[model samples]
Target chain A: MAPSDVNQGSQDDDVLQEAANWLKAGKKVALATVVSSWGSSPRPPGSQLAVSEDSTFVGSVSGGCIEGAVVTEALEVMESGESKVLEYGVTDELAWEVGLACGGKVKVFVEAVQE
Target chain B: MKTSMLDQILRDQEAKTPVALATELATGDQALIYYDSATGSLANNPEIVAAARQAIQDDKNGTVKLDAGEIYFQTFNPPLRMLIVGAVHIAQPLSRMASVVGYDVTVVDPRQSFASPERFPGISLNHEWPDDGLRELDIDRRTAVVTLTHDPKLDDPALGVALRSDAFYIGSLGSRGTHAGRTERLKGEGFTEAEISRIKGPVGLNIGAISPAEIAVSILGEVTDCLHAKEKKAAA
Candidate 1:
């Protein structure tokens, strides 16, 4: 599928629908959901992002501090068809570079979109 | 399977009913859980079904780790609704304030003149009698009913319907003397003291509000307080 399809569907509705659209378009997709969040997290739990095999993404797991990392992880999960839970926090080594300065933690669960 | 579950969830979202979808992350197996008596489980797992039902009742979304696998319970409940029983002076600002705070506001008054779109601007208005209007609105636990008519004939029937339903907040505009009289009437109509006490007479937080707008603020504030107060109780 074209990268524009991913972009267009990203802002359409919820992340689940975006992922479903991408899948129906024959795009390999993975889903990243914020399963948990600590203090000061911009989005609450159950927030999601849809990531295609081509690295295009939709929605957000963080305010903007961690989408790139989640996309990278999601691409890897798409390859292996495996689910993994990733954690990000202010105490991480790359926290400053990722802009997680609000002293909070979030856990994102990423899985290959397979029905 | 995902398509079926997603379709069901989308249907439930459109219908504005509380629905819980649980997915086993490991196997990608999913189920739709409805707490209602019929067809309660889709995944056929009792424990997971119970967890989903509990999540819906608690009005929360989270994960439940079972021996079978980790199931993510995605809950979709409709937005709260505020039904203003009278298109009186207070409802003008109250409807606006309620909408600002994320309530699907609907004003019901049989008086067509008072219930005009000119008075309410963009609100959903019902020009039917109070009881019939409330019946059509289908009050639920996520609904809040406020009667501002102050007229016993209009307010009483609305109050009877609201009190018997599962509306989270039921308030009526009246003074202390009026409330006392209302209590007697409700008692005479077979309402127990416990049920009658649920009505917040002199509706709204006692902020000494004077103007209609001020009273609307106090009422919205009290409605918010009631909502959160219920949440606190559920959390505890």
Candidate 2:
């Protein structure tokens, strides 16, 4: 079996459904997906994190190492209505500051869900 | 990502339909790619459409470089499935183990007493004959077929159907002698040796397993090995 992760198949479905429900409830939502990963990454490509306007989040892009930064970018995406990609690697200064200490790298895409 | 598009993707997922979402990085334009159709703003881009189709076939998420920038293809495939033909002792632990590994499991046994809701709670149970039940379930490439009955009456019919299907893994629980007998039977029934070779007889890894649960572990391990064998080859 593939390495176990909290954000597996069914959980991913739940995240997307929750994002849709939050949208129906009048909350702005942004979705962050791990577009690519390299080395001992906590999550594989396609792992996702859904964030609402108020910063309520579901799912994960990493073990919890880079979610804060992703959520921060996600809020900006919700505001701007434009998608953006963010890259983080253990070698980056920002990555060290954010504590992605697992010696892995990931590229995340953040986009707003428009009606 | 429009709410309607997201909803449609979720609907496809619920229906176990394989789909891919292609997003153009520069413009944030998106397209939904199905096996034979494409939709959304970037639907007309032949390059992106082809790449999306390839991604779906590969069952992998990836990026395609374009002159403009890049297109990200995220594939959503249906969960893997396991069809256990016989609610025997090994089936009990095997079903639970397979479920934990993310397979949508179905237990098939014609005997109601063996395939009871009590025996396989929360499992999809089919009391039809093995061949009929397997036909109804519609085995696909993502399915694994395991015949644990050991009884030729039950296991043989299931093996017949499974051999003709596209199931990625096919196994029968038995000894070498039993498997040899099975090979002869299948040959008499007109099955080619190559086709008969696909069944992993004396099934599971040779881990020296003796107990039912231990045997289940070895089978699951072998199943996992077969499931990822292609990717491992590619990586190599």
Candidate 3:
């Protein structure tokens, strides 16, 4: 898909639709939620985006800090329909080694969406 | 043969039943599901199917996005909850605002003085202790909790619950001084430096707000900021 298409579908509503498409197609899917945020947190507690088996991006839990990780986590839940919690900051190593440079930390919970 | 989840939320809203939206953020199959009081945790209810269709239609017609064909929010199980820890002055307006924005708002407080259905107007009122009351409401990633009470009696316990609970947007209302006091109290109560940091003190954007209504706007603004910032990062 083109970058523009990805960008265009990145809206929250559109992203949800992508997830819905996957569910309808009987593909394993997962949902990620931002349970907590601190510092210059990008999203609030309840902001959401959906993704699908194809890695077709839809919604977002974090801006970019952990999308890669979230995708990986989502895949795991998608298959087993289990729920998991994740935490992230500006930089993974920095967040772990020193502290969150952005001052805020976000906790995301990923779960397989049972439809 | 199907009503959409979005449609069910609408129906629930109209019927004075509460419903929440669950969106998936990563690359995996995502779908929207509604939690109902009766049917319990079933997904793909007729309402969900219909609402999903309408939500997609709204995206197609709405200016948010097009050309991308349609917009679908992710799918998740029921219990996408929104819990407000205080039904204080600002909460009245905040509840109204959240509803207009399509959030299912539950006004919770142990104080009868602050939490009343009359004061909250269209919002759901829960007159239970903050910690205990949260049990009735769903606290999850898709759920956002905001504390509108400035009283320690109300705010502190809610913060304690929120810190340990999974609800998102755990913010309290107060000035810098009040927030500082809260920090001290949370620390005294044994919250780690890290946990206390999660609280958005002097809550909302520093937009020089002074009224409950204005504060409501600012609070939601900050909440959106939290929401979009994460989304922006994810997209990048």
Candidate 4:
């Protein structure tokens, strides 16, 4: 995922903004931002997900778009307090495939938020 | 190694202060805020919030240290809001759309006849005239206002207020000719051409919309474009 190009007031952004508030309050959080989009993706660029210290969920990186994948990524980020980006829509013949119905690809940039 | 900021953030969330929660979701930290339009305050701000405002010169984010808290406002920026005027038809869908994007949207209008909770359902409906009503509401540096009502008596006065106030995006509904007339009126009212230029008359994007619902969607697109104008990608 590169970076958000279009700014949307989608649920994902709202949830992410909420989490940003938590971060300002000195909370340890992780952000999953949909950095890319393809075809008819539900969550577009700037869509975000905020994960709390105890694995609480706020916002979403995908609108049921690629959630299962994002949750797993959140778990990893939560464990190590590390921030990183992961790209979706990568097609592999051998990899387990979940067809994002939008036929559009979404790249979620997940970061471990820290002061 | 402590969750100092986390606790404060949770409380802010509970207390309904538009707390911005940031976490590392991927490569870098990603940020989001829960804005409480009612209180107009960020929940429990870490000491850093103050320092950010002071040293950073950009209240968006900065760093400082204080007791019982850790520094975490060291990310992205502050909150931005969406304000929709004229609780008429298009305001409904746009309100829904803006909500998805996390805007603490406020709909303003003087006609209580149209600006009722029953009409809008889940919006922050403010039954005040644009010129008169805006003063009480917080049309600050981070706000964007859209005037959907075509009637200038309702729309023009509000535009006057929004133009003077700090609303980032000031839009109004009108046809090309109507927009020109509105501009003439505004100019007649002693508004500068620069200020008049701030408005997106004939509001909504160029979607060639015909229906009210479609028009609402298109208008919302324009509003989002206005809100994200700075955040948009370079013409790729």
Model 3 is docked with a DockQ of 0.03
Question: In terms of lDDT, which candidate is strongest?
Answer: 2
Candidate 1's displacement at residue B101, Å, is 4.9
Q: Using TM-score as the measure, which candidate wins? A: 2
Q: Which stretches in model 4 have alpha-carbon errors above 4 Å?
A: A1-59, A62-70, A73-115, B1-7, B13-79, B233-235
Interface RMSD of 1: 9.4
Question: lDDT values of the candidates?
Answer: 0.79, 0.88, 0.61, 0.63
Q: For each candidate, what TM-score against the reference?
A: 0.68, 0.84, 0.51, 0.63
TM-score of 1: 0.68
How far does residue A27 in candidate 1 sit from its true spot (Å)?
A: 9.6
The digit string of per-residue lDDT tens for model 3 on B140-231 reads 66567888778898778878888887655778878899999999999999999899887888888988888889998998887766654554
Off by over 4 Å in 2: A1-11, A91-95, A99-102, B175-184, B187-194, B205-217
Sort order, lDDT high to low: 2, 1, 4, 3
Candidate 1 on B102-208: residue-level lDDT in tens?
A: 68899999999999999999999998899999999999987999999989999999999998999989999999999999989989999999999899987999999
* Residue B114 error, candidate 4, Å: 1.1
Over the stretch B6-99, how does candidate 2's per-residue lDDT look in tens digits?
Answer: 9999999899898999998767889999989999999898888888888888777756687546888888888889999999989999999888
lDDT of 1 at B197: 88
Query: Alpha carbon lDDT of residue B105, candidate 1?
Result: 94
Q: What is the lDDT of residue B77 in candidate 2?
A: 83
User: Candidate 1 chain A: worst 10 consecutive residues by lDDT?
Assistant: A1-10
- RMSD of model 1 against the true structure: 7.6
Rank the candidate models, highest DockQ first: 2, 4, 1, 3
lDDT of 1 at B214: 99
State the lDDT at B228 in candidate 4.
62
Q: Candidate 4 at residue A42, lDDT?
A: 64
